[model samples]
Every structure is written in C-alpha cells, then in structure tokens.
Target: MADDYIIRTEGLTKQFKGFVAVRDVTLNVRRGTIHALIGPNGAGKTTVFNLVTKFLEPSAGRIVYNGDDITGSKPADIALKGMVRSFQISAVFPHLSVLENVRIALQRPTGLSFRFWKPDSVLDGLNDKARTLLRDVGLEEFEPVMAGELPYGRKRALEIATTLALDPELMLLDEPMAGMGHEDISRVSALIKTVAKNRTVLMVEHNLNVVSDLSDTITVLQRGEILAEGTYDEVSANPDVREAYMGTGHD
Candidate 1:
C-alpha cells in the first residue's frame, strides 16, 4: 500500500526577529495527489514551503518525508530524496535554447565539468531525454527556440521541463501561475494537470479557480495558522474561511 502521507510536518513554526511567520502549522500531503497551500499575503504560505525545502530552518518543528525525519536535512538532501521546489524566482536560462536548458538540468546529476570534457557526440545523446521532457510539457515544438524569446507562459513551461529532468516524486511549485494572461493560464493549467497525473504536486497558488480545479486537498491559512483544511467545496463553504478571504481578499 502507499504511504499514508508523502510529506508531513508537525508544529512547524518560523520566527523573524520575534515575529511569528508560521506557527504550529501541521500539514499532510498524501502520496499521488495534488495538494494546494493557500492564504492571503503575510499568511506564511511561502514560509512553510521554505521550511519544508530546508531553504530556511524552522524555529520548531519536525519535517517528515516518506516517513523519515528531514528537519535537519539540507536543501540538496531533500531534493535528492525526490522533493524538489521550483522557486517563484524563475529557473529558465534566458540565452539558451529550450533543449539546452533541459539538458543542463539533466546533466546536474552528472557533474557539469565532466560533461564539458566528454565528446559532443556523447553530449548530443542527452537531447532525446530532453525532448521527452519538452514533449511532456507541450514544448516539443519550441525545443530549438531560445527560452527567453518564448512567451511568458511558455517560458514557465520550459522551466517546468527543467524541473522534470530531476524526476521528482513530489514537486513543490511556488506561485506557478503568478503573472499570466487568460490564454497562458489555460495552457499552463492544462500542462500542470498533465504532468501531475503520475507524480504528487504541492503548489502555492493565488488562483482559486486553479486551486478548485486541480487540488484534491486544500489547506487554508490566515495570520500564520491553518484556518481550514479539506476539499475545495468543503473549505469554500466554511463561513470562517469565507470571512477570512473576504476580509483579506485572499483569492
């Protein structure tokens, strides 16, 4: 049987100079599903992601992934364990082709310097795998195009392809749909759904429509604490959740 939870945290907390950013926040992300973490600004969603990824040390908490304690693990350690976080800060190579960008990520497990010393013929073999990832993200046609020249949404797709090169079991995306037009949103929403078919996804998105459509589970936070946790239909109907969203315009 599948593990009860792929990722879990108990009493997770973060303090910034005595100000609590996230406090006593427990989260459970089941294996093989799309889970969303959502809240208004300053509600500590990203902070929770940081703590899970070990990007920031939690003030007090235990992070367990696949039933192992990872609270003291480093960022790379968590990544190696199949938990990868795609930062909101962007991961695309502005000057490289889509194929080259993905190949670079594919070579990460193999040292970059070693690849540099190998024959161009051997390096060319990475193209097939790169193309497969591009295909998965619907960027196969753009493989030879410059990553930066693609439209914003396509660039995001290319970034997602780069992340896929690592073959993560649990993918954490921070604001995957941050700034996009309706067309881009549709394309990306479709792409996210496609990639998430086999792997688990945990994303922090402000788009409630996407949340409602993609999430199997939703955890709502307000003022650094969980206000509600359940299906979209369940949480959206909660009076307290409605009040929090209405008061802060969370969606």
Candidate 2:
C-alpha cells in the first residue's frame, strides 16, 4: 500500500507573526502505516501536528486526505471527515465515568435529536460499544470508575478510546507516551500497535527507541522544516539527521 498514501502534505507551512513554526514540510503517510515524527526540543514537531489536524491554519500549502484537498478546513469539519487528533494532554471529561466518556464521543457521530424522551435502548447499545472500546485499551475493568480517577496511563488509554469513537481513518497523536513510566509506556505501546492495525497513525514522539520500534517510516524535523524522512534505518543513516542528533560540537 506504499503507493496508496492515505495522507499527503505538499509544502505545508504555518507561521505565527514573523516566525515560521512549520516550514514547507511535505510528507506522505502510506495507508495502514505507522509514521513517527521525531526531533529535539523546539524542532517544530508539535507544530506540524497542529497544521495537519487543522488546529492551526497553514500559511501556505495543501493537505490531501484520502486524495481530497483539505488544507484550510476547520478542525471539526476535518474530524467529521474521519481525521481526528489526540492532544498531548488528556481530553476526557474528568467527572464522567470511563464508560460515559467513551459514550459521549460515540454520541457525537449519531444525530441524536430526541433529547426529552428516554433513550433506554440507545443508551444500552452505546454502553456496549463503549465497553468494547474500553476492552480494546485494557480499560474494561475501570468502566464504572470516574475517568479522572484512573491512573495516568489508564487516563491516556481512555482518551484514546474516546478518539476511536470517531472511527477515524487517520489519527494524529501528539506525544502519546508523554509522562508515562516504563510499565505504562509498555502498555500504551501495545495498545498503539493494536489500534494501528486498522487506522493510519502519525505520532510525534521524543523517544527514539519507541519511534524505531513503532514506526514503519520516520520523519525528522528541525527548525520548522523536514530534515529527513524514510524508514528508521534510512533516516538514521542520513547525514543531516546525524548532525541534528549530534548537535553542534558534539559530533
């Protein structure tokens, strides 16, 4: 499926004031591929995510998703088109039960117009679906627990489950492994691999080892531009990437 890239960006850029946060970064994330974006601090990795997810409008360039141009589309509109993002921070409702959190996300896609009448059957069906999602992320045990009370990793898993409710074709994850301990990281990594089996994932991560393990392709960014892009070995072997990783006077 290399020839059928699900997401493509052509000279995509984002500028804030006089500073360019993302510069002419063209990329192709092949269908069903796990593409990892890695770079040092201030390398504009998160900015690229922002641009791709429509959280920030691009200053220039075009974005093609499933071969359709969506460069300037609004975030909600883009999400409705089967592209969704999971932020670095958890977006789950703190007060809602774990199952309810996922249920709310499921409700978004359905045109639920009848609010006054009791939705007993609808609620039951949604409950079953939400449980399935929780089970997917290994959070089924905490379905009745308050979302805010779950462990850090479990909270993150809930967030991912909520995102899954959108049934996204392309999922943009910003540092999914952020703030996780070794055990938590391992769990999340497994969950990521499971989810990626059916959805295309493009993640920005700082852990090189994790990137190498999870990515079918890798892209290195520096100062708001793409430094290199290829498989782990190909990009790691690139002279520019080595220099970027080594930093000045370190090599």
Candidate 3:
C-alpha cells in the first residue's frame, strides 16, 4: 500500500516554543490524486505544508516522499527531489516581463550558475520552454507584459507556470484561490485541474466550492487535528465536520 502513495507521513508533528502546531498526524496521498486539506481557521494546514516543504523543521515525525525518508531536508533540496510549492501571495519578478519570470524558473533544473557571460541566445531553448509553460497557463498573449502589470489573476497564473517549469512530481499549493474575484477563481481553478493531470496535488483550500469540484479526496482538520477524511459527500455529511464549520444546519 505504501508503494502506491506518493506522499506519506507518519506521526508528523510541529511545535513552536513548546506549543504544538501540528499534532501526530499520519497522512497518505495516492499518486496522481488531487487531495485537499480543508479546515477552519488555525487548523495548521499551512504548517503541514511548511513541514513537508522543509520550510520548518518538525518537532517530531517522519516525512516520506516517493518511498524515501526525507525528514528535515532543505526546501531547495526537497524541490529538487520533485516537490514544489507556490506561495499564497504571488511569487514572481515584479520588474521582469511575464516570460522572464518563467524562464528564470526553468533555469533552476539546469543547475547552471547565473553567469553574465552566458549570451541571450544560449537561453533560447529555455525561453522556448518557458513560452510553452506560459501558454499552458493561458498567458501566451501576455508574455511581453511586465509581470506586475498583469492582473492579479494572471499573476497567480504566472506563478503556477513558474512552478511547472520545475516539472514537479508532487505539488503543494497554499490557498491558490485566496483574494480572487469569481472570474479569476474560475480561471485559476481550471488551470489547477489541468496541471494536476500529470502531478499529485495537495492543496489547502478555504473555498468549499472548489473543494467539492476539484478534490479527489478531502481531509478536514479542526484545532490542529483531523476531523474527517473522505469524498465531498462523505465528509460534508459527516456530523463532526458539519458541526465544526457550520452549526447543525443553522446556516
């Protein structure tokens, strides 16, 4: 069973100055599945992402990715191992053109030092790759536009394109829909589903509507612990999950 899982955690825990943020939580994410982590405020959803991405060291537990024990590895190292994350806020070069942001990200997997001597023509191949990624994310027409000049939704799409440049196997997205208008949300939501076709996606989402539509499975957390885990219908009808988020059909 473990062999079929792309990301597996055993008794994962994180603490800050003796305050436990994530408890002993064991999780299994099937390969090529869009597994969502949902919860009310302060449930440690992002903390788990930080721990898995190695942005934070766990107080205790083991993190296994692709059948290897990778507990406490550096973020760069984890990313090189085919795991990548996107921030809640847009992470792109504000001054650079939309295409340059993705071109720079494509440079990472090459392991080449940033050299002033490298001619622009040397990166022609990478720029082509970046162009493909931009098109994949629906930014082909905006490639020459300064990244910051694009609309917020397109900026988010650019960041997703940047992550795709890494060619990740497992992707962690933290609230990919935060602060978006309805049209922006729909666009990003469709982009997310397209990206997940070839990768395993584990996301922390507050939009229950997105969860219902995009998630292959859902894990509901409450007060730093898991309340329920199942399909949308299964977890939605769960007494504990409904009570924690909504009060006994009051809404």
> What RMSD does model 2 have?
2.9
Task: Estimate, for each residue in 154-250, the C-alpha lDDT of model 1 and write its tens digit.
Answer: 8888888988888899999998888888898788778888889989999997555668878899998888899999999998888988887774433
lDDT of 3 at 55: 87
- Flag clash pairs in model 2: none
Clashing pairs in 1: none
Model 2, residue 221: distance off in Å is 0.2
Cα lDDT tens digits, model 3, 45-126, are 8888788888888888999999989996788888889999999999999998998788888888887554436777877778
In terms of lDDT, the poorest run of 10 residues in model 3 is 242-251
Candidate that would win on lDDT = 3
Scored by TM-score, the top model is 3
For each candidate, give its TM-score against the true structure: 0.94, 0.92, 0.95
lDDT of 2 at 237: 74
* Prediction 1 TM-score vs. true: 0.94
Clashing pairs in 3: none
Write down the TM-score for model 3: 0.95
